[model samples]
Target chain A: MNHRVLLLALLLLALPSWAVIETYQFDTDLQRQRYNAFIEELRCPKCQNQNLSGSDSAISQDLRRQLHAMIMAGKSDIEITQYMVDRYGDFILYRPRFNAATAVLWLLPVGLLLGGLAIWALMASRRTRRVPIQPLDDHDRAALDSLLSDEEKPSERSGGNS
Target chain B: MSRIKLFLPLIIFLVLVAIFFGVQRRVQTGDYSPTALPSALLNKPFPEFSLPTLQGESLSRAELPKQWLLVNVWATWCPTCHYEHPFLVELAERGVPILGVDYKDRREPALKWLAEKGDPYFATVFDEQGTLGLDLGVTGAPETYLVDAEGIVRFRYQGALDQKVWDEQFAPMLSSLEEASP
Candidate 1:
């Protein structure tokens, strides 16, 4: 048990060194945060699914280096994003721009949810509005009294015999 | 009204299904290849840069011909460039002036390749560091740009250029630009 615990500890200790080390330097914490956010926002062109920070492809590495250079040179986020978009098209952005081509993609989900809710509410209201019980009429009251009397006379005769 | 309401979701679903198949069919038969990325530099002036030719001559945008030209990005390491090289040689021989941007390649091997295969470019600009290539929005080698007389970029095609690609993508654009030219 002790050996197993030591082995696990050693493995955990070696894990950090095995990870890929990023060499980018930021002057301030805010700059570093912005860099992280920017990379997370941008998709890696070569990898398709991974973001720039997560991709280990050569193009992604080059882009990261370029991003660092631009950030150090005081380029704004918009300028950096625009630079990438110009080269790679709008596909590089995780948050696509609102345009005619992508308007349906952005609006469809909300429209679907609203439509579903409307249908659900309509169904619920229809279910609640069941036909009300009508008041007993004079004819219905007379028929009910006669039925009760007939049942009571049979029971009375049986009770007297008992 | 309720009947229509009940069928509303089905109607939306059918419409979505139609759109999906339509897009799928369009993609399967589309003219644009998946690897071909649309350049934002279209209709804009070519990025300015001064580069040294492989032959030790300094070349710049001002030195380019005041007529239509093709700027082809190629490298020694790109295999597709080899396939497109002979076509370029043919175009060059037929009096088409092509400016070759040797992208991210060493000077010696590029010179050797040119010597062995015969040079197809009017002037081959050395972009060993790929700085000018980055400025021009070059994602990879074998990307070609068609520039008009005013140094304006008219069309960009990414991938190996051949007779079919030239006929389909570049030739039409070139003729239209020529027609529009005074």
Candidate 2:
């Protein structure tokens, strides 16, 4: 394929979504930022892994329009999320809410990290805390004496020579 | 306590394996759908829509046939709908009241497809712009919903429908829905 042809195709592809979104007139910079955050956060129901901003799928187009309408109507972030969730369930969210169904997903890794640190602290504290040594019993002392006999003989011979 | 700690990694591994096998079993038995989403409107009333039917006649929520029925969503663009057409015709012949939604499809092609394939629905709602589908949380075509007599959405099945799916997944629920009705 020619470079010119490839570039033309890409240009044409970018036209659709750009046309719709540019037509939207946001009142404030904060509202514009919210729109950007929203399209990124909301997952396209029809497409896998493509958020609303990335995909030009039919569902995404309709949802983008609805989201714009909601934001323009002064609906809060929570209300917008609730509206999407009510229709599409938690599947539409890139970041699912912390709830009974998703509690494990949200909490498990953090819980593991904390639990591991706690165990490490416990083990480390235990290791550094030295216990007092008991005096050697008579049997142990005799065993130690028998083990040192070879070196003791040299000392004995040296003392005799002295 | 420390003795059990030694087997903690082993326990975690075994638990993970068990969960994997459990999910695998569910997948095989069709209890879990890894791709198709469970409908958000489960046990809720069907979304309100006043749309023209396939024949261009007006219809509305209050005018819905007050009984246990299947609301089948399909489109000419979806190849799976073509595959499931015969099964739908068969079910309709067996006295199943099926309402169709022509999802995001041109009326001419949809009508042509139905005429050629043999129409299976009692009333086919024409949703050309897919507004009704958007309200219903449709991801794509060839989805089905079971609405009880009270207009509550009892079940939703994504993808094509067939006898095996009907017998295993839908039949028991349909029976229960009927039993519960006065």
TM-score of each: 0.75, 0.78
Fnat of each prediction, in sequence: 0.36, 0.77
lDDT per model vs. reference: 0.86, 0.90
Instruction: Report clashes for each candidate as comma-separated counts.
Output: 0, 0
For candidate 2, the share of real interface contacts preserved is: 0.77
Q: For model 1 chain A, where is the 10-residue window of minimal lDDT? A: A153-162
On DockQ, the candidate that comes out on top is: 2
User: Judged by DockQ cut-offs, is candidate 2 incorrect, acceptable, medium or high?
Assistant: medium
Tens-digit lDDT string for candidate 2 (B104-164): 8899998899899999999899998888998899988799999999899999999899998
| Residue B115 miss distance in model 2 (angstroms) | 0.4
State in Å the error of residue B180, model 1. 0.7
For each candidate, give the TM-score of chain B.
0.86, 0.91
lDDT of candidate 1 at residue B116, scale 0 to 100: 93
Residue B159 local lDDT, model 2: 88
